[model samples]
Target: MAKIMLVDDAAFMRMMLKKALTESGYTDFVEAQDGAEAVKKYGEENPDLVIMDITMPNMDGLQALKKIRESDPDAKVVMCTAMGQEAMVVEAIKSGAKDFVVKPFNGERIVQTVSSILGK
Candidate 1:
């Protein structure tokens, strides 16, 4: 069972993601509402994978990604970005994010990304 972290400002998005992943047979989950919380929780939960939104209050995904990767070089983070954020996605990739997903969350894409990353 891979431990996964879901980080997004919107509670609905997190819930949706959790629901989708659970239905797909993923059980373990940790959630945070913003990048700041995510950074703090990363150390505590040490999840196998993270699905994080790019635009968030108090630190943003790119910053959090850097900090997490700094602490754990092997950390696997998948960024969630909106359309037209290709520049940030490039930066995210350069900063060590394992992959990315676009917002308005697609259940199938999210599941596929998670499965590929965790090899589940």
Candidate 2:
């Protein structure tokens, strides 16, 4: 199983994502509460992929995404954004986000996206 990192300010959101991924048979996970933590953990954890929220205190996802990509060009990142955040999504893609998932997302969609990106 791939080691996945879930990055979000909300503990509930991280729990939900972990639950969804766990149900799909993904057992390995690393969690970060904000983009800053995410960036720091990325270096330490080197997760196979990162599912990150677009907005967070300390450092936003877009900025963190850039920093991670700057350090590791092959970093695999998928941005999670609330609806009406298409502009940030665009910026994320430009900044090397592998994909974007809208909030209120279903487990299936996220699972599929992760599978596809990880080439599982």
Candidate 3:
């Protein structure tokens, strides 16, 4: 069982990702409402994967990814981005995100991304 962290400022977004991940047979999720919390939780929980929203308060996903990468070079992060955030997406990739999923993503796509990243 993989431990995953879900980071999003919106409670609804976190809930949606949680529901999708649960349905895809993933358990042990840790949720964060912002990038600051995401970094803290990453240290505490050390989740196998992090699914983080790009636009978050306190710190954006790119910053959090950078911080996490600095601490753990092998961190597996899957950034969540909305439409028209191409530059940020490129930055995320440069910052070391393993992959990304666009907003309005389907459950199947999320599952596929996670499974592929985790080699499940």
Candidate 4:
């Protein structure tokens, strides 16, 4: 079981993601509401993977990505994005995100993305 960090500004999004992850046989995880919290939780929790939203308050995903990468060069981060954020996706990839998933939440694809990243 891979430990994951789910980071999104919306509580609903976090809940949905947690459900999907649980259904996919991922039992361990931590949650963060925004990039700042993500950075803090990541340092403490050291999850195996992170699913992050690009647009958030108190620091966006890209900045958090950079910070996490700086702290852990091998960090595995998958970005969650809304439509019309192609530029942000590209930037995230450049910043060391391993993959991306678009939302309003596709459960199967999210599971697949996580599985593929973890090579499961």
- Where in model 2 is the C-alpha error above 4 Å? none
Provide the lDDT at 25 for model 3: 90
For model 1, how big is the CA root-mean-square deviation?
A: 0.7
- The residue pairs that clash in candidate 1, if any, are none
1-103 in candidate 1: lDDT tens per residue? 9999999999999999999999999999999999999999999999999999999999999999999999999999999999999999999999999999988
Worst 10 residues of 3 by lDDT: 104-113
Q: What shift in Å separates residue 86 of candidate 3 from its native position after superposition? A: 0.6
lDDT of each residue in 48-91, candidate 2, tens digit only: 99999989999999999999999899999999999999999999
Higher lDDT: candidate 2 or 4?
2
User: How high is the CA lDDT of each candidate model?
Assistant: 0.95, 0.95, 0.94, 0.95
Cα deviation in Å at residue 51, candidate 1?
0.4
Please give the TM-score that candidate 4 achieves against the real structure: 0.97
Q: Candidate 3 versus the native: TM-score?
A: 0.98
Candidate 3 residue pairs in backbone clash: none
Q: Assess candidate 1 and give its lDDT.
A: 0.95
- Write one digit per residue (lDDT tens) for candidate 4, span 1-120: 899999999999999999988998998989999999999999999999999999999999999999999999999999999988999999999999999998887999999999999999
The per-residue C-alpha lDDT of model 2 at residue 18 equals 92
How many clashes show up per model? 0, 0, 0, 0
- lDDT (C-alpha) at residue 96 in model 1: 99
Query: Which is superior by TM-score, 3 or 4?
Result: 3
User: Which residue pairs show backbone clashes in model 4?
Assistant: none
The candidate, 2 or 3, that scores higher on TM-score is: 2
